[model samples]
Target: MATYNLNDIVLGVDIGGSHITAAIINLKEKKEIKSTWNRNLINAKGTSHQILQGWASTILQSMESVETKPEKIRIAMPGPMDYETGICLIQDQDKFRSLYSLNIKELLAAEIGYDPADISFHNDAACFLKGELYGGSLYGFDKAIGLTLGTGLGTSYTSSGKAEDADLWNMGFLEGIAEDYISTRWFVKRFYELTGKQVADVKELIDNHAGSTDFYQVFSEFSNNLASFIYQFIQRETPLAAVIGGNIAHADTYFMKETQQELNELLGYSFPVKKSFLGESAILLGAGAST
Candidate 1:
């Protein structure tokens, strides 16, 4: 690990469908400055200006956590986005519709009084994997896959210190698309289909009924489904390991063992499937790594 001077740190931010988080990371150290971490809920349904202001406010809060100002920043955000141009092309995706076709870097910079050129962007999934590869579980591996198991299946790959989006969420899968079976919506939908109860999300189901056999069965099926998905990706990519992150990872204790079991049985070996130890900070660390 390398040591970094305070002036070499950069602000790192993660933008989600419903929230935003920011922190500062020492590029040379490849470590997040814990004191600089901050997060805030954002209403993605708000108008463009409102959303911008909310993001700006949260970003300011994170910046305030540090003494010296950040002169450069990097953001990990979802797409359809033009990372190079810092434009958001997201549309009809149930979040941030107000930002469709807007240049997020320019918009956010204008709101926060920073030069747009000082900011850069990368795919959120890519950033997550990059963080892991740089400082988390995948640090020793040259080739690996990462999945952010949340509202959607965020996929990414890393090889030789470079990370990129897998873009496999929409690919064809069992009876529909990959995300149909691999995301939080799948858990909610499958649970509802099985029990006729409309729970908010998998977290809600786990929190309310984790001890129940019904929800346990749901997690079993989810583990099987995820294992199958990983099998396919592994066969194609041959990654040394698969690292998982996102909100659903909070329930890894309940489902990950079975997932690992299924993968081991299918592959005839113990293929590592590890949950992100860094959790939410992974993206911030990753955004900084990318910077």
Candidate 2:
């Protein structure tokens, strides 16, 4: 075996509608020893620059506290974003519309004194799959896909360790788009309106349902639709497996079972739905991998 010495560290950040998470990753050891800093993303917050500055503050503070100097910044953002230009175009479709034109990579580098060469960006969904493909739960699935069910639905498709495809988030779901119909935001809002009970979000529903038949039924319906979409994708461009890594994946096993059943019915062949192995650290590890 060839001996390898240490290399510079990387700072990874994932910006979701619900939260902004940051972590530090050591490239040599292949471990994200530092815990991440996550803060709730207020829909009513200031402009994208301001919001991003807030996120950067959290990340920088965390690094300082740990006495670590990460040499590169790797960020995973929502889709319809132009990774080549650092332009975000899915604003109207995203929960955060005001952040449409924010040049995140450039801004972060300027604010933190990091050179342009020290930063990069990718679709959050794609990076999620990269995380799985590299070392996450679906590590061995050379052909696979990953989904993150958050404020809005996100997906990343991959084959042979490269992520370059899209799926059921914007193109085909409900009447028009997946985010409008099947997001956790919709799941919680509709549930509260129908049952007069507030669910914190997907995580709460998965954790404390206590077999609320009505909620389970609604969730089951959503799962079926999601799985059906996945099955259709599999038919068009087949893959060996699928991995789930969103907050929703950890909840009541029944939801996954419902989804699996739908996939089984429409899937041309058999496969497995593995739970996420990396959790939040995936973005940083994946971001570093991108570099």
Off by over 4 Å in 1: 1-6
TM-score, candidate 1, is: 0.93
Give the distance in Å from residue 15's predicted Cα in candidate 2 to where it truly belongs.
Answer: 1.4
lDDT of each: 0.86, 0.71
Q: Model 2: runs farther than 4 Å from truth? A: 1-6, 35-45, 66-68, 165-167, 196-200, 204-209
How far does residue 216 in candidate 2 sit from its true spot (Å)?
A: 1.7
Which RMSD does model 1 reach against the true structure?
2.7
Instruction: Tell me the lDDT of model 2 at 149.
Output: 73
Clashes of each: 0, 0
**Against the correct fold, how does model 2 do in TM-score?**
0.87
Q: Which pairs clash (backbone N, Cα, C closer than 3 Å) in model 1? A: none
Displacement of residue 7 (Cα, Å) in model 1 is 3.9
- In angstroms, how far off is 88's CA in candidate 1? 1.3
